[model samples]
Target: MAGNESETAQRLIKAFQQFRKTGRNEKKIAGFNPSEYRVLFLIQRANENNSEMKVSEISQKLRVTPPTVTQIINGLEKDGYIERTVNPEDRRAVRISLTEAGLKATEQARKTFNETILGLIDYLGEKDSEQLAELLFKVHDYFNQLDNQ
Candidate 1:
């Protein structure tokens, strides 16, 4: 059993390395790097709630530090992809929202990411793809629970 577990761990590590390498090679869209795209994606998600996101919220969702999120937010703001306003409810908190340009860039990034994922799904076949998604989600949940502890 221990040997099996070790082998499984090794396989998981190799898979992660390969995934990271492949992700790095994915075609860039909207002139954004992967990290920038992630910030845009998170802001886009927050917009779905019909409310602007706070800097701390973005940091939590991205599992990054507040300062890191602020830095990214600063760049996005400078690039005109996002706007920040003082939260009305909390004077000290800043709310972030995507501008029209940000929306366009986010949409383009989403399209490219979707296409790339779909291509991988095609290669994996429908059934395997579904299974992979289920397994990956389970893994994510397991790690998430660990993190909360």
Candidate 2:
């Protein structure tokens, strides 16, 4: 790789570091722990299209064990952020859906996170950031395809 490649990789690492920092601070602001924040993010994304998702599917997407996902789900349920429902296709399967409070929390977190990201994107500017996103998506797709293969 060339110097530009190394520079881009370093920039990517720095970007992730910034995201981690902002994410941690955002959780604090939302009165949620990092683990809970992760669960909320996953649930929010799964429901982005207003679709319900199964616990097993969530576990697979998160690359987390089923028991771990269940444990997190239990905590969220207790906190009233989510509720479990039976899958009609398979009564034995459980699905997770965010409650009103959960949706509100997710929206708040998203707003805060987006503001931070938008600031970064502004600094990177329109064309550069779009190019960066395109390149990063391609890289992500490449690795994902390789994993499946």
Reference-based lDDT, each prediction: 0.87, 0.83
For model 2, name the residue pairs that clash: none
lDDT of 2 by residue, 36-120 (tens): 7778888888778777777788788878898998888899899999988898999987778889999998788767777967997
**Candidate 1: tens digits of C-alpha lDDT, residues 25-141:** 554665887778888998889888887788788788878998998898899899999998887888987778899999998999899888879998999999999999999899999
Count clashes in each candidate, considering only residues at least 3 apart in sequence or on different chains. Answer: 0, 0
lDDT of 2: 0.83
TM-score of each: 0.79, 0.65
Q: Which stretches of candidate 2 lie over 4 Å from their true place?
A: 1-38, 41-51, 86-91, 145-149
lDDT score, candidate 2, position 116: 68
Which candidate should be chosen as best, given TM-score against the real structure?
Answer: 1
Task: Name the regions of candidate 1 deviating beyond 4 angstroms.
Answer: 1-9, 23-29, 87-91, 145-149
